[model samples]
Each structure stands twice: as C-alpha cells, then as structure tokens.
Target: MSTPEVSGALAPGTHSTGAHSTVTAPPEASTFRRWTSRCGWALAVAVPLWLAVGRLLTDSAGSLTPVYAATLAPTLLVLSLVALAVPARRPSGYPSSRACGILLISWGCGIVLGFTLPDVGEGASSVLGSWAGPGFEGAAAALSNPLGIIMLFMAVLGCVVSVRHSAHGDGSGRPRDTEEDEAQGTGYFPVLDV
Candidate 1:
C-alpha cells in the first residue's frame, strides 16, 4: 500500500524546506520615554548655557553676577520647550536591559567621582590643612563656595544625561524594541522559522 499521503503537516522523513522568515513589529513609543527624551534634549541645550552664562556666575574674574544665576531657570525653560517639540524615537537596535545596566554603571561611577574628586581648590586646601592645621582652610573655601555649586550641577547633569541615553528609545524618548532579537521570542536571537 502507498504510504498514506501525510498532507496536513510535514512528512516524518521529508523536510518542508523554504526560505527562512522573520517577522518584525513596529516600535511603540511610551509617554515616559518621550519625557526622558525631551529631558535629554533639554540637557543638551543646557550644556552650552552652563558653559557660558553659568560659568560667569561662579567665576570671580568675570564679575560674579547674581543676574547670571537668575537667568539659569529661563535658559533651562527654553531648553525644555525645545526638547518637547522634538518627538522621541526608539533606539535603533539595542536591548533595553543592557542599556539600563550600562546606565546604572555610569551613574554609579559618576556618583563615586563626584564624591571623591576634591572639588578643585577645596581638595588641595583640604589636603594642606590635614598637614598644616587650619591655615589652609581659606584656600579650600573655593570648594564650598563657587566651585562646589558648579561641580554639583555638573554631576547632576552628567547623571541625568547618562541615565537618559542609557534607557532605550529614539531621540524623542520612547522605548523601542528595534533589535531583531528582541522582536523574536528569544531574548538575544532573532527567531527564524524555516
């Protein structure tokens, strides 16, 4: 008798071979992602201002100005508005978990550096004071006065940017499963059906 034609599925011996196929779903952006993206954009804008106007606020050589500090919020506001205008995009092909882990590491490193770095002049004076008693306190005062503020701002901004970039999504700040592997059921490999 001829082997009953196994029609419904592939035959036991014969292989149903064809070109491999893959399915990819469009990425979806979330509100939180968008917010973070916007923050990133804002932070980008702030970088320049921090370098220019913000610098003036701390530099005694530049006529330490209260007005400069007052202008900071407005500058930040402008940056925020600019960021909001730009829509967030999903990351090209990065895994969210990996990105998050990297961000955490960067944040941790930044925290450690921020705490350990001697805050410019302050660090030097503090070192001197340890050896020569309180005479060097004035030299170290810069750390507590202006340098400390700038350092704090830098540390905070650096952490924010690191966290924002590490998180998935496009420039617009949305989480996207752009990686081929992520779309597939496998955590790190693209699913292929033959």
Candidate 2:
C-alpha cells in the first residue's frame, strides 16, 4: 500500500518542505547607523589622545585655554551615536539600557562641564545661566565672550544632533536585523497529494 501524502502543505523530509519552509532574514544595519556608531567610537578614542598630546606638547599658557573643555560636547555626541549604532551580537536588554543611560549621563556631563568650567568665558555662561537657570549664573559671568558664545552654540548643536540621530535607525529608521539572519530570500509554494 502506498503511504498517504500530505495535501496543500509541505510534508516532512521532502525537498518541497525544505524549500517552502525557508525564512527570510532581517536587514543589516544601515549606513547612517554604522556611521553614527563609528563616530561615537572615534570621539571616545580621540578625547584621551588629545589630553595626552596636549599635556606633552603644550606650554602652560596654551594649556590654560578653553579648547580642551570645548571638546566635551562633540565627544559626548559621538559617544552617544556610537552607543545607538553598534549592534549587539546577542540579545540582551541590559546592554541597550546601559548604553542609553551612559549616553544621557555623558551628554549631561558635557553640557555642565562645558558651561560651568572657568575657561569657557563669563558672557557665554551668563546667557546659558539665564536660559537654563540660576545654577550657572556665576559661571556665566566668568565665561562671557565671543569665542565662548561660538563654542556654546557648537556644543548645543552637537547635543541636538546626537539626540536626534540616536532616536532612529539607519536611513529608513527601521530596526536592524540580527547579523546572523538572511535578510533577502525567495518564497516557495508546494502542492502535495492527500
């Protein structure tokens, strides 16, 4: 007697089953995401390098300038972008949550340090204090100056860009697929006898 065949759907151990059961994998991370991630890593790496080089190369007069403090915003922005872009190899809630928390903390620290530090200038501090609140009023008076204004603006812009970029995925803002999966594949239909 002949074995009964499954109908309409694929049967086990059949080539048709294998073909029809195929699954399409998710898409890889987008270029934008990758760029953001790399940018973050670069920023994190560059800051220490700058500090080390500045210490070794610059004299006291040059070292006192606000340039080092001014780099805070850009560094934080890059680090945050990196946290958002780098795809995790394995599923873990902690990594994502920790990353986000660190990003926020870094941004906050950058803004505070950039604004409150003595090198930033009094005039710029005053403006920031007036808008942000009284906590910065004293520093504002100390940091006021044209250069300080420009640096403050740049810092704000960096923060805004980093926050905006971190909210979305690569180009289309879609979630990236796991690296292990096949993002593109064909579907198959099979017929079977009852």
Candidate 3:
C-alpha cells in the first residue's frame, strides 16, 4: 500500500566508484569538458589585454592612450563568473549550468553594447546626439577594427563552448535505461504488480 524504503540507489551502468557514482558521463567526455572550460577561461582572461594593446598601437588617433568600450569592464567581470561556473566534474557542472548560460549571454550583450554606446556619444548624452558625433566616437567606431570584433565574438564563443561541454546539453552526458533500473530493483519509479 506504500512505496518501499528504497534508499534510491543509482539507476545502473554508471561506474562503480564510491561516493560519486551517480554521475553517468563517460570518462573521456568528462576530461574533454574540463579541457574546454579551461580554454574558455583562458580566452576570457585575454580579451581585455588583447583589446587594450590593439588600442595602444593604433596611431593617428586622438583621445590618445586608447580607451576601452564601456562594456569591456562588465564583459571581463562576467567572463570570470562564467569561467568559474564551468565545473571539473559532471556532477558539479549540473548546479552551475544555468549560471554559465546566463553570463555567456550577457557577455555577448556587453560586447555589442560596450562597443556601440561610448562611441555614439562622443561626450554627448543624448542618443541622437551621440550617434551624430564624429571620428571614432561616431558610427564608424564599430567598424574601426575587425580584430576587436573577432575577439569579442570569440569571448561569446568561448562561453558557449564552456557551457555546451557542461551538463546543459542533451542526455548523452547522462543516461538512464528502464531495463537497468528494473535489474537494479530501483525500477526508476519502484513499483510491483499487485
């Protein structure tokens, strides 16, 4: 008349190590996931430096020294957040999956907005005024450098790779078979014929 006291063991075919067996992702896939996340972390860290150096090298440009877009700050911050979200283990990846997705998206938004806004204003506060300004601070700013655009795109792409390799993808990372459950006496739902 009631569900038995089944401590709810792992379904089956999940590996036989102690205390962390619930994770079903294969060993190779797990290793690869960790690698991608690490790579993403590295790329995210480099974006600012790369952009700054590029700015510094550009000559014949006023506003000297080279100034980063407004979004650069936020993008750098979120890059860290996303890097941390990518976990070394499949089980750990589960909890931070959603956060990774969110931050990565924000990373894209920051790139687009940061590059666009400051240039628009040229010190002018109004939207129309900003766009109406001249020089790199104007509409042409976005197209000033192709490398910067590519780098920003890379940051977004890196975030995606980190998250995709995590638990957010399809069930291949984890699988539970009905037969396995029955054989283990767990039955997934744990029932018996009356």
Candidate 4:
C-alpha cells in the first residue's frame, strides 16, 4: 500500500494515518525574547493611557492647552499605533525594518513638534511649572523646561533602540534558517494512495 504524503513539517516519527497527518509547531521563543516582547506591548499600551491622564490633569487644573493637543496628540497617536503594529517577533533575520524606521522617524518628529509648537494663550505652563519658577513665563524658560529636556532624552533613546532592533534582529546576530528540516531532505511530502 502506498503511503500518504504530507505537506510542510512533521515531528520526528510523525506519519500519516489514512487521511490525517501530524505537523509540529515552531519552537517556542526564548525567555528573553518573550520578556522583551511583553515589555514592548506594555509600553505601547501605556502611551495612550499616559496621554489621557495628562489631558485629564490639565483639564482639571483649568490649564488645558488645546493648541498643543491639536499638534502633539496626533503625532503621539501615530507613534502609539506604529508601535502597536510592530511585531514583537519576526521570522528570524526578516526583521520589521520598515516599521522600525517609521517608528524612529515618527518619534523624532513628535519630539520636534513638542519643542517647536508654540503654547500660546492662558494655558502655557509646563508639567513641571516654568523653568524660572511657577510664576515666571519667559520664552527661554519655556523652551528649556525640564519636561522638554526629559522628552528629548526619551525620544533619542527610543530612536536608538528601534535602529538597533532593525539591524541586529533582537540582538541575536543573524537570523537562523527556519527551513532546516526541509534543507536536510526531511520535509514530509508523502503521496496519497489512489
């Protein structure tokens, strides 16, 4: 009797039984990969939450900056969406280079928007108050505020990380060949008996 052929990968000793064939799943990700993936997901989720809370606080304090939101919120929303869309794990060396690049650029733009956009009118206070003190509202102080400095640092860090991930593939050097079994002539492609 002729045996059936199965497409794709099969575990060792796996065989077709009449009409059914067993295929093994890919190997589990390493602990470090899993942890980093979770962290990425968590940070993606936290961005929106942080934005909402900041808005709420400003609204409550009667110092809401709609102009800032109009310009900066959209940028932040784009950043969050891109971050979420980025895959936590890719197929070995086939990293999400394009997505990472977009993320890096968007983050840099957001930082620039935050710094250059004018905060006019009655609600022009920084999160950490004025750099010259709570009552001082000078342009130099506004531009050199602690919050802006912190944001610049964070944006730089995020860009660096994205670049590294795109180039290094999770810092694991080159990607492994996932088709090792097939390369070794072990791919099960049994022909079905008539």
> What C-alpha RMSD separates each model from the true structure?
12.9, 14.4, 11.8, 12.0
Q: Can you write out model 3's per-residue Cα lDDT over 58-170, one digit (the tens) per residue?
A: 22223422445345544664755464565444445432333344444544444444333332222332122234444445453444355345545655655554454453333
For 1-194, candidate 4 gives per-residue lDDT tens digits of 99887566656645555456454433444554455445445544444334334434443222345544554454455544444344333433221333344444444444433333333446555433433345433553455455444544454444444433433334333332336436656554334110
TM-score of each: 0.29, 0.30, 0.37, 0.39
lDDT score of model 1?
A: 0.37
Best by lDDT: 3
After TM-score superposition, the amount by which residue 12's alpha carbon in candidate 4 deviates from its true location, in angstroms, is 16
Ranking by lDDT: 3, 4, 2, 1
lDDT of 1 by residue, 1-194 (tens): 78765455543434444543333333544544444444445454554344334323333213322333354334433434332332223242222222323333333332222222221332232333444455654654443345434434543443344344434333323443546336654454234210
Error of 4 at 136 (Å): 7.1
Off by over 4 Å in 2: 1-17, 47-115, 118-137, 140-194
Report the CA-based lDDT of candidate 2 relative to the real structure. Answer: 0.40
For candidate 1, report its TM-score.
0.29
Q: Name the runs in model 1 displaced over 4 angstroms.
A: 1-22, 55-194
